[model samples]
Target chain A: MLTLAGVGKRYRRRSVLAALDLALARGEIVGLLGPNGSGKTTTLRIAAGYAWPDSGEVRLAGEVFDPDQATLRARIGYLPERVPLYDPFTVGEYLDFVAAARGLHGPSRASAVARVIAAFELDAVRTRVIGRLSKGFRQRIGLAQALVGEPDVLLLDEPTNGLDPFQILEARRMIRAAARGRGVIFSTHILQEVAALCTRVVYLHEGRLVELAVDGRDAGLEVRLARASLDAVRARVHALDPAIELRSAEALGEDRHRLVFDLGRAGVARAELVRLLAEFADLESVGEATPDIEQALNAALAAQARGAAA
Target chain B: MRGFVTLFARELRHYFVTPIACVVIAVFWAASGFFFSFNALFVAAPDMVSAFHNMSLLLMLMMPLVTMRTLAEERSGDTLELLLTLPVGEAAIVAAKYLALLVILVLMLAGSTLAVIPLALYGTPDYGPILGGYLGVFLLGAAFAAVGLAASSCAANQVVAAVLTWALLLLMWFVDYAAALDGAGGAVRWLQHVSFSVQYLDLIRGVLTRGAVVWFGSVIAVGMVVATQVLRARRA
Candidate 1:
């Protein structure tokens, strides 16, 4: 539903987005993971038509976005990094105003406002002015404004920035629910949120697209074993087959070690590695390493840095 | 048109909910009324013409306070993003704010009309000049509001908006004063004729010429157009 081709943005003398390419299909919830000053917000702003890219183009549903063409704005909903709200307006009134601004009129406007209020679960403080609401409520109201128009594409910058645990879960559920028929591109630094809410992850480092990975179930488990030594166990495993390359062997405690190996390339199987280790030392446990999104992100960033240095 | 109406209503409702609009009107009306009563009742003047002149000055000060928050507050609060992202033209947003300020000016003019009641009751006042005076006040208020809105568009905060607007209004008023000085003739005189307050004074003396109306209308039109351009360029 959204396409960005060779997009770039520069501020002052520094580049924020560098020839970035991104695509979002319908009903896909893509999380943009990046640290500060990584151009995540800049990319989202360019997509929302709030900030124009220095080069290249952004297409929404096959239509090129000319900043002069105001009609295209209706097809996209954006929640800025800092939720800008009129504090004097009540939650209901704010939604009503947003509905009307989106060109919904009469009964349709009323119903749109009502639907968003209910969908975001804002009934409790609907009558209260937004300035008086808690941060969680304010964040919900910001998201509520974006959802008021039911746009085809939603660009949210740090949607769960300042929420409590419960609020974060509620926001995750709401975002997942909205992704049923719409394309969502949410930028966040929270790796856990990406694992929990996003179908795919887009990693950004220093204004460049690093990697895009599909989020999947944890296929590996992690176990800390107490044994004679990781080197002693690894030697026994290597004795089974000289082709096995030990990834890492680190001492945990007194005579305890954490061992990691590349099981895929090894000629021997997991059963063989376990049997050889058991023969050498007392086996504490045998398991797989769990998938870690943070580890993946760090690796991607580290590789990008290395590439830049090279 | 729907978007414009919606934004305009929301701005008007915002004023009613907050104390900014009310405080401006109250302070303006009270201050102007006191000056008028002191000049007319205490000084034993039988006419309210001078009182209208003083009220015009009051508008030069108060109109900025009324319009300072129109766009500057939105920009600072970050709500301008929400407004700009809506499927509405920039002209619609500018026109809506201009209309909202005009409505507030009308209501303020209505409140200031109370000063005319005593003149009508106790003294034999000419209704023609009184009517002309109110019309002049409305036009001057509109022009001031427009200038204030333009300043608000450029400023990032309400305080800066108010200060910039007041400076622009003061320049207009000072232009009229400087035009009347000796030795600066011809072109300067013509420039002074374009002074917003000077043209407004011409209408206050029961002289409602089409030229004066056109001048004020043109000022408002240009101010709003510039404001719209600023908004569009920033987003771009």
Candidate 2:
């Protein structure tokens, strides 16, 4: 199991991640969903041991994940957002070096490199320099590099970013196959990919982790299935946070009033808004906040994270 | 460690598989040969002291180009991210790269060292100064390569890396001459002690002093340590 307890990170006065708590066990595929500048990359960077969190800690199998310890670091295979690879190196040569650096030696190193090459279907272009390969082949080569040592955990950042539809399907399949016995945390904007691949999801808004209900609940959507006071709920929301104004209240009769939150103008924390919604007991079945709204809310969230950091 | 050795071997392959290492070596040998032949033919004594000075000066300028891409290219290409994520210390990465460039420098100098055989063949050249001069040249190359590696890490691309490295090496080489303008005995001695060219003068004189060897070795160590720090800081 891998765990991040109260992990936080800041870039100058801007907090990129704040008080994140999460865990991953083997055979679980978790999707990290976030808008741009929401600290998804920072979270992955900290998790990958490439950067240290400003606060809290990460544990790998009950031990603190020390960056100084090669054995601990060897247990992780990371594919950064940029597809970090030497363009001039052949796929075979690159994987060979990755395997050796991951602590696989001699015959084991050769076998490990071979295993990933075959698994990622890189054998055909193993001799080809990465600079000359197509985007799909390059992406596959990046995957092969990460899978070389058969690590216990995988951290992938937008694995299917620039791939064609066919290549995207191939990459999705590869992620499924690769996560068979290892814990996988992948970040992607494609909700369909999350629905298709992730067993659970974590959302980041302005570098803060939004702890959505883990009992099969999405962060941004719910349908009204109960009768409760709409006016009382509106009063409570305003009282809890003055700037918040309930956008619309529709009467469903028999003491039921459907409340639709205008979160875009509210600039309220998701947790606070969810808490206000929970009080009504009439609201239920809300879908995700929606990625389309991601841009409109980016500034608000960024301002919020920066204000909190300050 | 396996990580260090792996990185080192990879860098060496990068040097040879491309035309980079061959071009650098050819140009280096041509330049050194031109300077040596000119000095040997034109000088009254036909000794290699001036030739060695010319070669060291040539190497001072060329070594950064040899090392400029070592780290800067990795950063620009996004490979540094992959390397840092590996289960290896920053020091290992720095050491492996610096050693690889230094080894290439030493190997290139071996070709120049062979020029001494011809110098000995044509005239009554003292073999002691030639041996000391070669040793000095090797040390000088390694030191400059280290400086270049440090500069590469600080740069965003290879051109900036090469320019920064040149600026740094030139400063170290000329600081003693700059100090001479001060005309104070104690300051002059101290500046000479710190100057790379002044340190090289001992070997050029066939003195082979321990202090100069230690000074060059320290420069290599300090330069590499600075490079390692730069690499580690980038992770944040």
How much does each candidate deviate at the interface, measured as C-alpha RMSD after superposition?
A: 1.2, 1.2
lDDT of 2 by residue, A28-105 (tens): 899888888888888888888888888999998898986676568888889999898777889889899899889889
Chain A only TM-scores, each candidate in turn:
0.80, 0.72
If scored against the real structure, what TM-score would every candidate get? Answer: 0.86, 0.84
Task: Please give, for every candidate in the order listed, the TM-score of chain B alone compared with the true chain B.
Answer: 0.93, 0.93
Residues B1-236, model 2: lDDT tens digits: 53899889988989987888888888888888877777767865556787778888888878988999999998998888888889888899998998889788877777777677786687777777777778888888888998999999999799999999999998998888867585566788888888987888877766778888889889899989899999888877
Q: Pick the candidate with the highest lDDT.
A: 1
* CAPRI-style class, candidate 1: medium
Worst 10 residues of 1 chain B by lDDT: B40-49
Q: How many pairs collide in each candidate, listed in order?
A: 1, 10
